[model samples]
Target: MPRIAYFGPQGTFTEQAARTFGDADLVAVETVPLVLAAVRSGEVDSGCVPIENSVGGAVTATMDALAEDEPLIAVAECVLPVRFSILVRPGTRAEDVKTVASHPHALTQVHDWIAANLPNATPVASTSTSSAAVLVQDGEFDAAVCAPVAVTHYSLETLATDVADVDNAVTRFLLVSRPTRVPEPTGADRTSLAVVIAHAEPGSLASTLSELALRGINLTRIESRPLRGQIGEYRFYLDLDGHIGEERVAGALAALHRNSNQVRFLGSYPKADQSPSVPSAKNTDDDYQAARDWVRRMREGR
Candidate 1:
């Protein structure tokens, strides 16, 4: 069994996610940065880091580490469903709640719930969701927005149930490993690659993307970031369906090769894991908006 690392503090949802994907041999770390560092250091065979949450959109820290300084390649995925509860001192009541604290991501997930129910209460951010629970238990705050597991660990009360405002929210976690020489595709694969085009040349972007369309390949995602040492130049990072070994994918890449000055393939791997459902009316809208409002109150209260 391979060892995997993820954000942890014993009972965090990140730890649960690691255990879900890693079986019983998972190691829990403190931060997304540490998870990436552990993989780069080869201390673990792989690491799992949350990439995006339905509520929060993207985990910007994880994206920056994967995009900027690291050579880690995404290998597998874990889609973890998030359900949040408000925990507070054993005797705390809804009327007595003043401020709520939780990890930024956790706080964001349950933002809607807090906004509607805790109108006057504030939300605070802690190092981890579990820590937020702990702080809420010890501090004077009325409550903490945390996981159910954390509520049990902290011996706090769940002032509200499923207050998260959304029933089907999920976070996508990527299992990354040291870059592989050639990745073997499991069915339903996605390829991730980075390319640099002539900054001043005409039709450069067109020529690159057109090849994929011409070959009937689906361009799933296209993102751009600055190329190192060049302020004006940017590198395009893409995720598309089809493996490099496939003829159409190969030919399109070849066409891109001829059209662009240079291309660096990060890796061709699995598509991201995400929920399968129509966007909930409240989830993308109400749930997220509510969560944002609650987080604003919490941050402002401090």
Candidate 2:
């Protein structure tokens, strides 16, 4: 059985995502770095960790790890519905709760609920929501805002269910492994890249993005993080709507390479939602191939 590492003590959203990645021997690590390190060191076959949430935005731990000097590559993407609950030790009444503990993202997800209901409860951060549940199990906390699954894991009781302020809360997770193990791209795939501009100029961001637009590549997400040790310098993380294997995507990346200082090819994997059908157009792969062939013919003649 494959040994998969996940950000967990168990029962966190990352564990749920690991399950979505398929059956495996799950190893629960305390932090995102541990999970990635396990994979990089060959201690595990793969690592699964949250990358983004619809409500709270990107999970910087996972994103920064990918951007850093790790020889890992994302192999798959898993998205899971996240539901938070106010869990407490059995026999702990809701009225007796004076503190709420959970992962920071989980805390923010249910902020309004906690404020409206627990009003004066002190909110504490834990490594993971399941860790918060463990705290309650050890009598360290009065209650925890964690996944419903965490209740059973730590023998806690749910004081409230679906406590998240947003009913549509979802967390996106990425399965990462060695660079040699990249997954074959589906036509309806997403290519992730960590791009650093050659200079921090006014139009640098726009110029880098224009390469994608010029090739008709649609951007699904773009986020910037400060470069380490470089004040006023930023690196962009992008998710664009095409596999790296596609012609237009390859062309765009080639252009980006010429325009940027460094372009880290994160990985290309199937989008969580399968490719939607085009009205009356050929499949993207066929179109890309035909277009490439035509362009090659024109270049050869020239």
Candidate 3:
């Protein structure tokens, strides 16, 4: 049985994702680094950690950890819609609430709601929304912005539900493991890579990006993070729209690796929200096979 570690105290969204991941023994850890460490040290078969939130943007800790020297591979991705509730200890009325506590990113997601409802209440940051619920249960805070599942775990009541400022708020989580082998293509897949520029000069960044654009590889995301010990130097993290098994994706990455200072492959995994197959004119399996067949026929004639 696979042992999985997740960022948790029992009621976190990471825990929610893990529960739905599979039939495995799950361990709850207190932080993202700990979850990653567990997988790297072989304490667990794999671990799950949030990589990005639609409302809060990228979770830098997860990204930086993957970029480190250890070389962890993201084997899969899970996306969950996040809805934070205003939870209070049983019998604690909304009128009695004077302070709000939750994860910093959670607080940002419900910014407008807190401003309109708890205008005078001070907002506090916790390790996670679940931890905030724990504090509220222990009488440390008046109310907590947390998941609905936490209310039962912490013996709290929900004063309001779906408190996120945006209705479409979602978080993307990654199942990371020590580098072994990349998962096979699932037709619809995503490939992640870290690219460091060979030089710091004007158009250098654009030159790196052109390699993907020139190949018609659609990029889903691209972000830059400064490299440690190298002043003013940065590395780019990118998500492209195909599997490493595909010809175009492989060729583009090969070219990128040759031109860039360094390229680290995070992993190519099945995309969680892949759309149903839709026919396209640009590229398809049949087209690739037909082109290959034409080349084979020419070789035979020669």
Superposed on all Cα atoms, the candidates' RMSDs to the truth, in angstroms, are 15.4, 3.3, 2.8
lDDT of 1 by residue, 36-84 (tens): 9998999998888877677777676776677666677777666777887
Clashes of 2: 0
Q: How many residue pairs clash per model?
A: 7, 0, 0
Question: How do all models score by TM-score?
Answer: 0.73, 0.84, 0.86
Which residues of candidate 2, in runs, are more than 4 Å off? Answer: 91-100, 114-128, 200-202, 275-302
Clashing pairs in 1: 100-124, 111-290, 111-291, 112-290, 112-291, 123-298, 282-287
Candidate maximizing lDDT: 3
Q: Rank all candidate structures by their TM-score, best first, as comma-separated numbers.
A: 3, 2, 1
What overall lDDT, based on C-alpha atoms, would model 3 receive against the true structure? 0.83
Pick the winner on TM-score between candidates 2 and 3: 3
lDDT, each prediction: 0.72, 0.82, 0.83
When summed lDDT is taken over every stretch of 10 residues in candidate 2, the lowest stretch is 276-285
